[model samples]
Target: MPELNVMSEPSVRPPMTTGTGKPLSVTALRKTYGGVTAVDEVSMEIAAGEFVTFLGSSGSGKTTTLMMIAGFCEPDSGSIVVGGRDVTRLAPQKRGLGFVFQQYLLFPHMSVWENVAFPLQLRGVPKAELRRRVGETLEMAGLSAMSRRRPRELSGGQQQRVALCRALVYRPPVILMDEPLGALDKKLRDQLQTEIKRIQRELGLTVIYVTHDQEEALVLSDRIAVMRDGRIDQFDTPQELFERPRTPFVADFLGAANFLPGRVEEQTADHTLVRLDSGGLLKARPQPAPPPPPQAASRSASQAARVRAAVQPGRLALCPPEHGFCTGTVEAVTYVGTLVRATVRPLGGAPGDLVRLELPAGHAPALGERVGVTAAPANVSVFPDVVPDTESGG
Candidate 1:
């Protein structure tokens, strides 16, 4: 991770009248199209200068919530409050928010400087002041040399930087980005992610970023709101979301997790003991809080009963069969750059029921080898098992 240039001294630049950044509050935002509900009562509070990502797969209502926040799409009900002012009914242009779309949205007819200056021009900023602001933004984004170039003349990444510069030129209190880096390749995306973070920090900008990419959300966000069916499933820091997901979907979506079918044998204030269906006891820290119930009745009784224990691939370690919590046979081994991943089939599990284990490259077992997998109780997360609905693709 690149170090953020957090300054202790006051900036020499003129103070923004619109406010550096302000807390954003979304209160029960709901939207429906025809008979299908797109967003269902989503609410979240974003602090000033904080970077929050709305993360979810397609049709999950992430984009709808962002659109409502941007004032582009009107909600059927609820309100959007920015800096303590209600802006739900305000026009997009009057909301005083910056926007960066996936397409870059740069005018082909305009030069890089002109693209960045468009917002200032719309606000009727004086020519001299506009020129100075645009120049400074271009320089900060390392695009001063390309100021004379058109959108077509720049690379995809450069075009994105130009788009970002345009959004920041006005210094809006909140900047909404809708998968702005989605068009670029992996290498370029990674580079731009770092650049975006650096710029956000330097400007103390409150950013509400939207992306379906889990890794991108994890990398860029100080906190993440994991959306599902138009509601937030979990809103938390990346580490918390990964280590203490409230639901199976969040756990499975954030990363690879081995879900062992189990029932809560004993629940206590600190720990919960579970009995695995295949055999053996496992222990996990009890969840202190349960997530908000889903808007629709979608969970099955069987799934609700089995959500007692879940462990990530990295948390499970190989142990002597006699001392292991669950014994299995190594069915396959894959070497992925820094770590080796093994597929293990539990001794009594149904055929095709396998667990993934991530181990040091040198410590991986050979195929057809017998292995016992056990995890420290501290690393395990106990929650109600949420079975995915095949038809709904939960």
Candidate 2:
């Protein structure tokens, strides 16, 4: 095995501000309400002109963190730095953040232009300047033509576009969005999703977005922070988060995963033999080098770090089919749009360990057919353990 350096920091973009002026940073961030901990010690830095997202399920602390950054909630312990200065206790308005919500939150009596102008008006900008600013924001939000319409007069998507314009009218440096598309239907939500990306990119705005939808995060963010129980469990670019998840929870949360529990049975120069508790032997490629002696630790640390990085080795499952090992009668099959899933009971598989294979729909083997299951090395993802490795063994 190659020497593994466990302390290397991953590459990340530096925090910066948007076109407006707001900047954001959180250090040792924590939020508590009575006895309940709503957010743990979360630290983040958002650079200017970057789009970052808080992605997780409800109660995962994504929204709470967003609220803290927006100055809507006070952190029990932590520092929020914006524009290179600490503003942990500043008022929301003083922090210069524009916030949007799932609901349109527009005034029923106001037209789109009036709604967009409201922020400028509150800031005491003159009518002439406010009108110009509102017009610019309306155009940015693709709502210039609907500027005269009331919120009720627009479709859900149009109302949302107006809300976005209102949020941007004052041109705050950072925009905090809390599931802003949640209230829209699927088609409208998808449409607005693209629009949000385009607008954020074109204007070079710093955006901190919150969403429970994984696909949304994948599509919208340059990077994602996955939260669990008020703490950030992982933060990385979406591709790294998906293809090389550092934890089982992240892997499972992102998509369907087949977890095969196992133990290292033996190790050789080239491979580690892992014995699956489910009764199969898996061949895993070894790290390129082994740890160096203590006296040379520092000299070899960097080299070891590169070798210890996660490897994208292919995984295999024993089953009856082309390249599969275990043979069994098909128990059930379900046809989805492009693929068919087959549930089969292998000779040694536990009740819950029944294997599922996704094949092209029309080519599915019939139910009750005796067949073999095969896995291509590249089709499988091998984690050192069913759980994340705390120390290097792979």
The best candidate by TM-score is: 1
Model 1: weakest 10-residue lDDT segment is 1-10
* TM-score, predicted candidate 1 vs. hidden true structure: 0.89
Distance from true position, residue 110, model 2, in Å?
A: 0.6
The positional error of residue 208 in candidate 2, measured at the CA in angstroms, is 1.1
Give the lDDT of residue 125 in candidate 2: 89
For candidate 2, the per-residue lDDT at 321 reads 51
- Residue pair clashes in candidate 1: 307-383, 307-384, 307-385
Tell me the spans in candidate 1 whose CA falls farther than 4 Å from its real position: 1-19, 268-270, 287-306, 389-394
Model 1 over residues 1-394: C-alpha lDDT tens digits? 2211211222354633333777899999999999988899898999999999998888889888999999889999999999999999999989999999999889888888788888888798877677767777887798988988889999999999999999999889899999999989999999999999988888889999999898999999999998887778899999999988877778878886788877777778887788887787888876553332353246664445555467899888998877777888999999998899999898887676788999998898989988888998888886655554322323
lDDT of 1: 0.83
Taking every candidate in turn, the Cα RMSD to the unseen true structure, in Å, is 6.2, 12.6
Lowest lDDT 10-residue stretch of candidate 2: 305-314
